[model samples]
Target: MTQTVGSRALSSPRELTRVADRSSFIYLERCIVHRDANAITAEDAEGTTHIPAATIGTLLLGPGTRITHQAMSVLGECGAAVAWVGENAVRYYAGGRALTRSSALAEAQAVAWANQRTRLDVARAMYRLRFPDEDPSGLTRRGLLGREGDRVKDCYRKNSERTGVRWRKRQYVPGDFTAGDTVNQAITAAAQCMYGITHAVVAALGCSPALGFVHSGHELSFVLDVADLYKTEIGIPLAFDIAAESDEDPGPRTRRALRDRIHQLGLLDRCVTDIKSLLLPSGTQASEITVADSDIDRVSLQSDHDQLLPSGTNYGDEAGW
Candidate 1:
């Protein structure tokens, strides 16, 4: 979750001490400010403090949280991004650097390519999973097969129609398909969480988040990869529900609710597991890909009422694998 700044402000702050050469700890009180340091320790009001440079992949500070210049410098040297929560709880800060021993540019390019391919593969897999009975060969036909541009548009339309929400005039123009209100809000929330998570993962792997495989935008490459996987099912549906409940405008509470729903949807956990399986060395085989039949049964039971119609409720059950 991203941090947010509250109304409380600080009074007097202290100067940060440099600890680049040695392992040092710093403490943070309700009112204490220090300069960025090369390496220093820190403690919170609860007495829970440490030199995070050694362990944290990304450091996120809430509003009212203060750091010394010495600590900031040390964090930068250690290749950590210090993100701060704004008054609106949005995260804003800097310090994601490429720390490869090889040429930074070359490493960034390689990573970007690999990440792009990975994202595409994941997108294809998710589409196939969502529509297992549909013929893949027909997906590209002009009249029947849905194009990427059209698919995005259809996703917006279907979501908006399903939720009864209208898009702001400038939010989307004629022929310029923007994600609908529900999906857009959900996307924003997911994007925020995914940004920090992807950055953390990239940092742990000694890669730069700015140098993404498929994404080229300055501040969003890595998060873009994560979003590509999320939008297909999880974010789309969750956003639709949120839009349905709210009178079209989703506030922070709605975003929080959608976030909780995403957790229940299990997309992140499943995606992480799938990625881990893909990244494991070739020799290591995944033991199993299991889906609980009980869950399917529960869904089927819940939908039994609609099956009573004259249509006979086949629901694609006869489609062959």
Candidate 2:
């Protein structure tokens, strides 16, 4: 939707065609990305390097990268995905805003989530979309969970056999967080990459990461929902392949392997398409904007408390949600 600064819509998404290089880049060195006059620049011990703010797709920040608030705002406006990584592995910790100004997707998400039947239907659709070969019909949420878990185990076993990396039962030492085992560490690394990509896509579509259909309670629950779709397909293979190499430490190797896989599969584009397809069903347009005239006036008049009656309802206010 086209918009102006004066419009009620808070922001407008930038043109996706503006994506430069057609590829994303990672910043591993300690550098600061900040606004410099008309452009964004990254400065480090070596020297100051200019960032092509308008063209790049996702700008990944590994350890030791510092980004200014202004730079983040610039990236948001540019419709570029910016990700902050975890301490040990390149785990996705947080992300910047989406390019979209429209609230259509978010509102649609809320409406679907608020309705139990619709939410389950959407969940079923998600499962079917992710696993096209599998049948998800007539399955309850718990049933879906059980099936999904079985599929995951199957994937681990299948990949282990293919890669010849003795698939031990999936286990992790929780208190350490740093995976003691190579397979666990590889899995952790791969999952975070998927999360990073999924988070970027979620932001691009202007959906809320906190509101999820299957998974809930935690923030980035929606992100987890979307990323889980590719977990078996992407994460499992990548982790096992890396672990098969007996690569001493799976953290860095997993990051490299996952990045390559993400690029090769064009996972980001797939993510965008999957989100829109799942959220916005075929032949159905997002709702039309029909903000009431009274609603608009109420916002403009709410600033003056004295204009309202003592009961707190505006003197003659009848129009509200």
Worst 10 residues of 2 by lDDT: 289-298
Q: What is the TM-score of each candidate against the true structure?
A: 0.47, 0.78
Score residue 268 of candidate 1 by CA lDDT: 38
In order, the Cα lDDT scores of the candidates are: 0.44, 0.69
**What are the clashing pairs of model 2?**
11-101, 13-99, 20-55
What lDDT does model 2 reach? 0.69
Tens digit per residue, CA lDDT, model 1, 160-184: 7777766442142223223434445
Alpha-carbon RMSD, candidate 2:
7.6
